[model samples]
Target: MRRITVPIALLALLGSAVPAAAAQAAPPPSIAWTACDPAEEVPEGVLCATLEVPVDWSRPGGPTIELALAKRPATDPSRRIGSLLINPGGPGGSGVDFAYFSGSAFSPAVTDRFDIVGFDPRGQARSHVVNCDSDLIGAQYTQLYPDNRAEYADLRATNRALALSCRELSGPLVTYVDTASVARDMDAIRAGLGEKRISYYGVSYGTMIGQQYAELFPSRIRALALDSNMDHAQNIAGYQKWESLAMEGSFRQFTSWCDRTEACALHERGALAYFDELYARAEAGELNPDGQPLPPEDLVNIVFGYMYNPNSWFELADTLLYLGQGDGGQTGRGEPVPNGYLPVMCSDFHFDVGAYPVLRAIEQAQNRLAPHTRLNPLAWSDLASCQNWPWKVTNPPHRLRASAELPPILLANSRWDVATPYEWGTSLASQLPSARFLTYDGVGHGTYWRSDCARAAIDTYLVELRTPAKGTHCPAVFPSSPVSAQAVPTVVDPLPQLTGPFRR
Candidate 1:
């Protein structure tokens, strides 16, 4: 199998060479720790700090940027391992806040064994942020998945204006907010911590940073656990197809549950047909939920958002029922729109603005193949933004590999994830020489924080360096059954599994 041979190939490749800078670099300046502002949503015993890293790694002593940090020291220092840095995805998500939020909830064993560390990657919130026009961003977001050639032209113009605005507001820093730069920033943090190597836990987009770090400084990793991965090897078309199919797959699973379970609020004999009607009405602009009418694209996005977790399916069912009745209220709970997502994603991947027609045709073909969940506006928006982006990416798309001398890493993902998708995690695992994959056969974007099985695997791996056997699957906690919807207690949104802690 390719998976079996990849590690062997990577080991040979890594063992043959080393990065000269990483090999001979001196420690950067020490960080100054202080009490976090009381007004900030900080967990107990969390101290704040800042590290100065180069905006451009090539010129280390040139322009500098401050990266904010948060730390929860190990409860039992005598038994403590070194610092374990954590990033909760969002190329934009604030790691500093994540330290306070997730760190506060870490199990005693983990808190006692390792210092929980988190940092806002350069150009993210709490760091030197990339500011854009709030009004323009809100207005243009989700506005450009046009229905006609004329509309497409409008989309292009809108994108051009938005792109120009972003560049004007963001300046040169926007071009440098790539994953490669973020990885270098991680190394700076590692050296500042006085650790020979550091452990890491990265979720979603955060995994990209982890992968890059492992490739650039393979010998500097103590341990790594990547959950809900985003495959950096995917080009624009591949990215669109993968995400569209994943979203559709999750939608189909939700409908299947409804077909078999009476407890689902939207349970009916022809559930898929009912959904088709909703989609048609949204497309025709004949259905308005609450006061605003949702375009077919926005409607699909709403449904896709609920696909993040099975527990939220009931809410999704209710939303569909309301739409069926020509009533509109709030849809089901959704993930917070990322502020830093566009800047970072656009900067990392290559997108061709001139290829919009061809790309849209390809997307349409993919949609036809998967009609149940078509109109993937998320992919469209990302590609469009990148096409129109005024800045160049300092770190372009690339695969990742760990040096043979680095510690083996762990990866976890739910089998039915939509946001980052399960296959992305598998893809990442295959590419890395020392990666072990853990699968959760459940519904959610992330697994480690919510699933005991996943958490146990990660904990054992971090504490004892015991990798889970390949092909291991964690059983789902909530299995589908036809029961009363009201009888089952609804759970709080699991979307916050990563984003809640670091939203400052």
Candidate 2:
């Protein structure tokens, strides 16, 4: 999933085309941008605009699509150094939101250097948004039924209907939302900005977009920073991690944080004991924090939901703790799992479980690997969506290494990031010749390289095109990520892990 924006003044990207790669992989695609409302200006230094593109690049001219876009101008136009486009991680992340939320952070020095930009890619967020209607809503990525497998068969049928719905609603657009096409869109923005080369900073899936763009338009890069790395070469199949492991990963990180605290509910002699007891209570169908029957599996989904952003870590711990607390602590709500987390998490990735059987099969495989960790919502998400998706499941290639010719790329990962494991980023970095690795031994995703030294290194790179030493570990807490000349974000104190599930 991709949030397609960064804060910058303005520029162009196509809205509605599908990738020519799907039709013919020979030559890469190009983009043509439609006029967004450029004459109109938003409050302050921002502007609102749109890029009209084809839904499917394969049939580029057949149908048109629109991408919602925004830009935050450089504070000093006199010293502006083209545009610095930003894309957040989620395939479903909102770039416009990222700019709105973090665009200011890059201000003063960074904003003076480049205009920050953000946009929602087609089929997600404000672009060509996708909706599965009500019936498909609750079924979401669930195993289906009232926790019944047989009922899941029916849910599978419903999921197939979702594909049909997408086909009908999205038409030519659904197929073109791949990274390669987005890369082409990047080129369009570069052209619109009137810059021969484009500078960019992408996180998570955005990193993959940056990867594809660099691969296709090597000469077009001025300066680039890729925060979290993704193995786009892996395709749709290896995406199995979307399942329970997603949640399990978060659980491990969250529980480890709790292990250091004595009062933490699940903080038995350690996190493991607390977790064991907590699960036993959920398994026994005891009263959950909300007073509803703890489905036992809801914890997985909740934890899985929490792992995506560092901002949620504290809430995640408290939420989990509250869930396992029964009616004694909080209000007597009905269920343990908060109802809100599902829509946000499920919407982040379009698993389209209707067509992929391989993901479903992976469920049994997961149990074999980590039986105790299996059945959690994250794992279940990996499996359930595949079971019901409309497409066939096949192998997606893995990128043990990336093409060596890209610009200086930065790989950042936190040791305890539940959403993305640290090793994966390092392994991906190991694959690229022009990349460097920074490990944050602290908590949270993308924070591994969040320190000022790391920031200064990155900031200096963007402004002067430099790279940090090949392998460096930022032991002290770092800033969220890097920017031009960043010293590092200093917190008053190390945030403690919020209390969570109390094991026996």
Candidate number achieving the greatest lDDT relative to the actual structure: 1
What is candidate 1's lDDT per residue for 1-504, written digit by digit as tens? 001111222222223243554534443355677999888867779899987666666554456777899998898999999898988777677788778765444556577899889999877788887776655565566555655666666666666665565556655666678888898788777767877788998887888888898888888888988888888888877777777777787788888888877777777645787899988988788888886787777778778777765766878888888876865533332222235667787778887546556756866876885687774556666776565566666577877655787678999988877677777888888888678899988777767744678878988988888899988999875535424323433222223644542120
State candidate 1's TM-score: 0.87
lDDT of 1: 0.72
Clashing pairs in 1: 97-501, 289-328, 290-328
| Each prediction's number of clashing residue pairs | 3, 67
TM-score of every prediction relative to native: 0.87, 0.73
Weakest ten-residue segment in model 2 by summed lDDT: 495-504
- Alpha-carbon error at 279 in model 2, in Å? 1.2
User: How many residue pairs in model 2 have overlapping backbones?
Assistant: 67
Candidate 1 wrongly placed segments (more than 4 Å): 1-27, 327-338, 479-504
Candidate 2 residue lDDT tens string, 202-262 = 7666777777777667767877787656654433334444333544565665566556544
What local lDDT score does residue 426 receive in model 1, on the 0 to 100 scale?
Answer: 81
| TM-score, structure 2 vs. true | 0.73
For each candidate, the alpha-carbon lDDT, in order, equals 0.72, 0.55
